[model samples]
Target: MADATADLAGASPAKLTTADGRPLKSALARAQAKARRRAFLLVLPLLLFIVLTFILPIGQMLHRSIFNDGFAANMPQLTQWFVDNPVGTEPDESAYAALAADLKSAAEAKTIGVVGTRVNYEMSGTRSLFTSTGRKAKNFEPPYMQAVLEADDKWADPQLWGTMRQVSDAYTANFFLAAVDLARDTEGKIVQAPEDRRVYVMLFERTFLIAGLITFLCLLLGFPIAHLLATLPLRYSNLLMILVLLPFWTSLLVRTTSWIVLLQGQGVVNNTLVATGILTDDTRIQMIYNQMGTIIAMTHILLPFMILPLYSVMRPIPPSYVRAARSLGASSWTAFRRIYLPQTLPGIGAGALLVFILGVGYYITPALVGGASGQLISNLIAFHMQDSLNWSLAAAIAAVLLAAVLVLYWLYDRLIGIDNLKLG
Candidate 1:
């Protein structure tokens, strides 16, 4: 009994060992960790590439939306004065004195124009005020507030003071507010911008409306084509696929130009209609250089994006399912609605998201085809960046657009799941 007890104790759950006498569990864990490290190392270059090329630029743009140092950096004394004072506090002699000194310094440095330009973005017509004031600030003597007001009564405007206070901080939400067509009043209360200046919100709404329309159009047109392709034999489908891919091989400019040629009044379609008595020469359709032109051009360009995804998802679905439903006494329409439609949802989600995202940022097609009435938010972003030279406002607009897209993506992930987003 004593011997048997000792034997059982010795045999009780001996530590696992590998063939080479290393502990098997520990060895397996080490092997797994090494494999993971190797895999990460292999992907390290790709990760770095994405960070540098994509992530860093987006991060920089988002940062620019809230941060501007044009006034704060250039007008240090005045900025400090404003920071020391509470909002709505009437600027006293000391604040005016500080402003005079800063303006003098900025004028000497030839940077007053930059500061003025920054201020003008928030308060129109203030560019000349800063530049003209700075040019004469050198000759101004004591009783600076009275002297400054004498130079320009505009200096005493509470609105200008409020604008200055708002921009005193190196970081502010003013650009974001401006992006959404909101502003801070003299009392520091948020308010809607004046009617004439309230354009950005409308532009954003139009942008989304256009994108949604394009997405709907793509789905409406793409679904039937994809279904046909999937149902057809491989030999015929491959031939049809070439037609779909043909547009992709063509230059985007060329495609847009082609649409212009086809849709313009003097173009082939209208001329043909005129010759065929469908419409008189005076009654040729007004298509190009309008919303209709934008829609048609974008739909053609983005159709392939929709078709490819739907085709990939549909090609795998067996005909047997539909046949089985039919055998079970289900009507053709009922079988498609219940079984086929549900199965294609993943593809629809992927295609719609891809098309919508692309459409929202569409610049070239809209810029060329979309006239003033048809212009989108991207056109305004470009206008600010190049024409208006309001880069900070442009950056702010881009950041807002990016935030909106991310929110939509997050909602999509929560509802449909990112794992379900499949692409060929």
Candidate 2:
């Protein structure tokens, strides 16, 4: 029995040891190793998913932005016209012949429009250059070149030639510039979009403005609710918390649609206002089809994100902090501001960041409620991708959107770091 007992002791769970068996790892090290493994396992799925869905698509789109060569690839015979130049500043006669041949062939093949449109995506006048030249050129030689020069003194413009030289690739920054409401002139100078078409810049400004407003509303409204949740009795707090979460249980589309029905001209809100005599029967407030509707709907959808984070941070703060401040002869507002408000900064930052980021990319709420002026950048992006069939333009806009979001995130991170230092 003693031998068996000794054997069982030897077989019992042994202390984990290093190779030398000198107490292999500290508790922290063991825990860290377990955490590292768990973290890697937990993140692997998300990493793979993002790579497949986001990273790959973004990379593909960016690649397309600079690629511009469907025509050149299909027609190598026209290349002799472009390259036959004598390697001097003046474009040689052979170069002109090559141009005429290429244009004639391109026009005959019914693919002149593709090249023209692609070039026009960068320089608006390019379509005129190609289209007018093709139609007037009875031959690919002097007459066509003369027509091009006569049609626009821009033919004398070497910069337009430079743009033509660059179109052999399938990608160009033209779409990106156009996405931001800028365009390249014949001289290749980037300038503001024409006065008649300055809508894109306004759209970008509106998107940011709406996002900021929604974030502000979220923080202002959510802070008090979160404070109540953190301070109240656990039962009551939990009930309110459940209510905050209840919206998430319903489909997002359903909620947005409901808001539409509730806020529209003849909807519940307008009817109530009219019945209350605040609004005359014929005087309808335009709430549902404007920025107000978007803000209200988005705020409702995103309030939980703000509340939960603020509540989490506030709950850990003990009531004794406020009591201690009060005992020191601080006023009620002073105690709350000095002792309570500072502790909640982290949650405030987290919740604001969450809501702001979500708001920037909002599409459905804005689309359903936003009339022409209320539409955000995302709506235009969708229109370019689906309605306009302009994938390059859509991709360019998406790239800008991603860049803007990253800049905001970086600023948020910097501010959060500073806040932590102040708190510490």
Candidate 3:
């Protein structure tokens, strides 16, 4: 009808006009643009808030992951020396002279700590070497190479020079390499970290492994509960739903600590079994402060996420469909497999993805109950951020985790079609 009207309007000698004698098409276009502008104005505050709180911080994190100028900014002469020389260049007397000048200047300016920290990231224990040397660099005379080496034997190491060269510039991928348990040799070739120091990769693998287990457990434990809730009558379902959501009202710390009280060696679970004569007190099972603890606590916390989505999808599925299949000479299992199960796939996917993502990043519950064995990569990231003050490396680890999540989302979207995801 609209096309026919347009044809008629085109064939007509007189152009279409509004009541105000303006062209109708132009008037409609103007009204649409005005409406769009009004809508944009209405949402402007929300857009600004998201940009400020979410987008900007993520941008800063990405930037920090690649750029750090603590060393280059403070040690100008040494950084200039690095720029002038090639990768394999050996530091001669001139090099030590430049280092001595920078150290003395950095010491006087009180920026020696910053310079030391950047190098310390690459070569641990060099922070004190730089600071201690900086204190005495002012008295160093000609033949400065001898003076510097005499002050600290570490100053003579070629590997230390290679590291200083690496951090000479404001930007580098070394932090990212360190995040994955890799580092560079004195010749600038990348290689695996020492066996004892190869930790980040292992932590990353453990993190995903635990998250996958948590997601599977949540699905396993939640599927029956969700089905029960969906099939039960309204009065009972509401009561059950309140139980499921009750955790959300309580503090997460409280829930985790409560689990600690129940799962510890002498805690409620062990005491109950001992009292019931199921097990002796000396034979109590070790449940807390290990991978099992992390898995159990996380599964309980994330179970509601799985249930709500499954329940939402399941509630709308008509019981008659299953009964009809059963009446059509199919058994209950066969009917569910052929009809009911396929209907809940969206909820399963949504819930699994939600629980997995949350489990991957969980920290507090793991910290309280996980102990040494259950700690995840986030704990290492926190260690870098809080204890070590290595914000650049922390940001790099976070960036890698975010990249992994995006890759998972991409693969899920490719295989299952993201449009099918349904969350309550």
Compare the candidates by lDDT and give the number of the best one.
Answer: 3
* Residue 310 lDDT in candidate 1: 98
Backbone clashes counted, model 2: 12
Ranking by TM-score: 3, 1, 2
Q: Write the per-residue lDDT of candidate 3 for residues 1-424, one digit (tens) a residue.
A: 9998888668643467788988878888999999999999999999999999999999999999999999988888989998898888889999999999999999999999999999989888889998899999899998999999999888888889998999998999998999999998888899998888899999999999999999998999999999999999999999999999999999999999999999999999999999999999789999999998889999999999999999999999999999999999999999999999999999999999999999989989888899999999999989999999999999999999999999999999999999999996
For each candidate, the alpha-carbon lDDT, in order, equals 0.92, 0.77, 0.94
How many Å off is the CA of 8 in candidate 1? 15
For model 3 the TM-score comes to: 0.96
- lDDT of candidate 2 at residue 62, scale 0 to 100: 83
- Model 3: residues >4 Å from true position, as ranges? 1-14
* Model 2 TM-score, 2 decimals: 0.78
- List, in order, the clash count of every candidate structure: 0, 12, 0
Best by TM-score: 3
Sorted on lDDT, best first, the list reads 3, 1, 2
Each candidate's TM vs. the true structure? 0.92, 0.78, 0.96
Give the per-residue lDDT of model 2 (tens digit) for 63-100: 76555575465335444434444222455554555666
| Model 2 CA deviation exceeding 4 Å by range | 1-45, 70-113, 123-166, 169-171, 418-424
